[model samples]
Every structure is written in C-alpha cells, then in structure tokens.
Target: MKFKNRRNECVTTSDGREIWASRSVTVVVCIVLVCEDQPYILVNQRGTGVPDCQGLWNLPCGYLDYDETTTEAAMREVWEECGVNSLELLQGADCEFFSAPWDISSTPHDARQNVTIHHGLHAHVDRLPAVSNAHNEPNETADIRWLPLAQADTLEFAFNHRARIAKYLSHLERVAWIRY
Candidate 1:
C-alpha cells in the first residue's frame, strides 16, 4: 500500500499516537462496490499536501463531518474520496471497533491511547453502464482506478486499505455463495 499527500490524510505520532492535522475531526471511509454481473471496487489516490498518506492508493474514503450519520457519512465519503455520487451502504463491518492508523490530523476521542479501525461497506445500486471505471481529477486525486478483486489484491495500497478491501471481499464472497 502506497501513500500520497491529501487534505483528508490522517496524522499520527511516530510511536503510533493518533493525531489529526485538524482538531476534533471524524474520518469516515467506505469500501464502495459496483456489484453488477461482476464485483469491482472503487479506489482513489490522495493528492499532495495532506497530513497523512498524501500519495497512495486507497479505497473510496474520507473524514466524517461534525453532524453526519454513519450511513450518510459513508455515501459522502464515496463521493468526495472518488466521485461516486450515488451509492447505498449495504452492511457495516464490525471487525474493528475504531478505525486505526488514524489518517488526517484529527484523532479519535481516545485514538492516542487505543488503536482500532472500523469502516462501512457501501455498494452501488446502479450499474456503471460502462466498464468498471473512474476518473482522477487533479487537485484531490491524481487518478482513479477500478480494479477487480483478483487484480485488486495485487495492488499496493496505503495504510490498511488492502486489508479492509480483502475483508470486504471475503464477506461478499460468503454472502454470494450463501445466496446460491
């Protein structure tokens, strides 16, 4: 997993202390899947000049605002992080209570003392109509790439994006098989 400079990046101390470039902040990230005939995920690159991972590949994600529901936060994250405006959060991942390796300059209430990372899974209802794809608008993201799970696993993402993606894929695979 590589990292890049972006405003939404998380900040942390060398010894793994959680900190944010901004004070009192909430970060919300969503692993968006365009589940059509096949399953593909949305990823974006954080541009330069952010507290955390300024230049690295990551799943569609960002920090939550002051007053936003987790579900709404997930949807907004997809849009701001990558540009997928329309999305629906299917299920939530509880593997980790709190999101860890805290990106950005903001820290959780007890982030400095505790290290846990959590995020939600949002799947798009509408098909792309085109190939699984995205755009990298300069400024925030230099580029965007939609990779199939198989090929996606081969990618090097920043922080725990890869792990999170893998976890979501495993869950999806299980649900898919159970349905059949």
Candidate 2:
C-alpha cells in the first residue's frame, strides 16, 4: 500500500488496514567494559556539525547504512564514535538480545517526517582500548567518555538514548540476579 495522497497523509489497503512507512532504521550500540569492579559504558558528545543534539551526550549510534547489516552498522558506528573495534573486544556479545524494533514515532524530539525503527545491542568488553577516539566521524562526534553505569543513568542523554541505556541496565540487573 502507498500513501493516499500528499494532502491525505494516510493510506488504507483494499482490506482497510492502516499502512506505516518506516523512514529509516538506526542501530544503537552500548559498549560496556568492566574496570575497578564497576561496569562503564561508552558515550559520545555530538559535535557542532551534527544535525541535532549538538554537545549532548549519547550512546554510540547512527543510521543503518544501505548495504550493511544491523551488526555491521553498529560496529561501524562504535568505531567512528568511540574508536573501539567490536570485532576484537566484544566478549561474545549476544546481539539478538536487543534486536527488537522500537517504534519511536511518538517520542518527543523525534523526527515527524519518518518513523524511526530503533535497534539496540550491548557489547560487553573485558578491557578498554587505549585510544578510544572519534576520529572517523569527527564532526558528528565530539568527546568520547566512559562513565560508570550508575552515573550514566543520572545524566541526560540525547535522542532518547536514556531509554535504551535503561533497558541495558535492567538487563544487567536481571543477569546479575540470575547469577546470584
């Protein structure tokens, strides 16, 4: 089914089912490393040239590229924004844990022209890379920092990343409880 018209802005199939057009898909990767017996997550501040959220902190994330899988896109974003190579550091991350699509159409500060399908995943690392720099996408990312999970929860994040981080934190709590 297609959009009814430019003016109508809604579509209906012959069976009267509403159709939704997904504008784009974005992959968000939360890289976690354990240091000093505490878990820290990688975060980046948006640089000046970013379309929005300049100077605001967010998880390593970006739009899914045309010819890349979700995992590939996530890896690329992590490298570009956090200077970490997931392929080398990830300690058997279960990518499927956070593969579900989240419809962020109604979220505040979200784009209204297109629906955003947010896919998130957590990459647990045993150690941090010596140089975690945002060199590839210099304009899109400003500073890279690793914050303790508890401290990260207190900071405001851009692009609804706080929700994604909360989900990861909840999962961590569940896993810890299960292990106990």
lDDT of 2 by residue, 94-167 (tens): 44233443324433233433334444434445565654663655587777888877787677689778877776
| Residue-by-residue lDDT tens digits, candidate 1, 127-178 | 5423222433345675566666567767668766787666655554564431
Clashes of each: 29, 0
Quick one: how many clashes does candidate 1 have? 29
CA lDDT of each prediction against the hidden true structure:
0.52, 0.65
**Residue 39 miss distance in model 1 (angstroms):** 2.2
Question: What is the model-wide C-alpha lDDT for candidate 2?
Answer: 0.65
After TM-score superposition, what is the CA distance of residue 128 in candidate 1 from its true location, in Å? Answer: 2.1
Evaluated against the true structure, the overall lDDT of model 1 is 0.52
Q: Clashes in candidate 2: how many?
A: 0
Stretches of candidate 1 off by over 4 Å are 1-36, 88-138, 174-180
